[model samples]
Target: MNVELSFMLKKMLSVALMPWSIAILLSLLALFFLYRHKIQKAKKYLTISILWVILISWAPFANLALKPLESSYERLENIPENIEYILLLGGDRNNRAWEALRLYHKIPNVKIITSGHSLHDPISDAEKTATKLIESGIPEERVLMQAMAKTTFEEAQHMKERVGEKPFILITAAYHMPRAMKLFKKAGLNPIAAPADFNRPEETGYATVLQSKQLKNTERAWHEYLGILFYKLQGKI
Candidate 1:
């Protein structure tokens, strides 16, 4: 079953990156060659294989999936003065939690929902986030932690259930906002976005071009976009 799943994932990756026409053509050629030859033919496929790997793994292409999230975040004016809670998605260490917690402090009487998957009993990220907030002087009673959610969909679902009739913010990486918002919306949560850790913010011209992080950022962006598409196809998000 693991082998079958791996093979299916490999097929998805190849189909996602290569155009349908090319994949079909290659499949037909591969089938033709599979008829009688026990030994694999010659080596002409290596160059194409290398190019595909490079394109799939490289930076700017990766951000294809993440850019829309970045744009959604840039559209907000100051934190809406009436936010009820702030939902911080877990995955990062101190930085992401701190950034969201800062906002949690700013809004008057704002509750916080920190969500993550806990592999251990006593070491949840939700607890870490809550502990940090309490140390930061926010009352312990005001912070809420949702620790059972392991994936974005489950995180949003948990938040939606907890957030009954409340306005909240979804804080995550700029590259992740697009898919995060989509999932939250689907889960029936109208969480506002508070995206952080942007590689670039409103800069134009050659600056975006020459920065090393741009490529890195773009790669991350595309990964999320690919994930969103995959989830959509699977009806998981």
Candidate 2:
């Protein structure tokens, strides 16, 4: 499939498969059933829809699904002396860039490479991130942009082309690190994981209240899970 089409399809699927979307879909189906006078079917679908929304938004339920992904990789300590670059994959741009900025301070003489492009923005995400880094006091020369990659698989491909087998720090969200590592390694790049943008709280809590933050975390976790599965099916990992 063409890359653009594939990306579009993935985006559509992602929105469709989200918990909120599923709940809405079920509710709509229930409405249709009710219009047709199928009361039992309508009631069944409506009940499931309500339950699904409540479950996904509940704190304990969300935490149970999200913690594993967030905990997959610990923060990078004991920085290797040989590391010369930090490949920061873009998502939650501020958080990821903040982590990269912090790492740049610790790692001497290292260039930070930012990768990602946005469909809705005219400027590529990489260039935007690079500009932010420069404004944050990173030397403009030390910030490189690889903006062609729109997905993790493409990011790995572009990084491999630019860096070859050279080792570098790979910074991404904690939840995304596991799949990011797999894709980069498969692309033949040696990446040391520097997972950041952690979504899970350090202190565990079990609350029955519906929280939007918890729902967001659950969505993020499912996104990674779906990404990994999609990549595997496409034979990219």
True lDDT of residue 166, candidate 2: 93
RMSD in Å for all candidates: 6.6, 1.6
Per-residue error for 178 in candidate 1, Å, reads 1.0
| Worst window of 10 by summed lDDT in candidate 1 | 201-210
lDDT of 1 at 134: 76
TM-score of each model, paired residue for residue: 0.68, 0.94
Compared with the true structure, what per-residue lDDT tens digits does model 1 show for residues 1-237? 674466567556745654333434555555555564622631233345444444444445445534566777763448877888888788445378767666765788888777776755677887877787778888878878888766688787777678765768888887788888888887777788888777553334332343445445645665676768877987866
* Tens digits of lDDT, candidate 2, 205-227: 66565778878888888888888
Model 1 CA deviation exceeding 4 Å by range: 1-42, 53-66, 91-94, 120-122, 201-219, 234-237
Q: Which portions of model 2 show Cα errors greater than 4 Å?
A: 91-94, 202-207
Q: Model 1, residue 24: displacement in angstroms?
A: 22
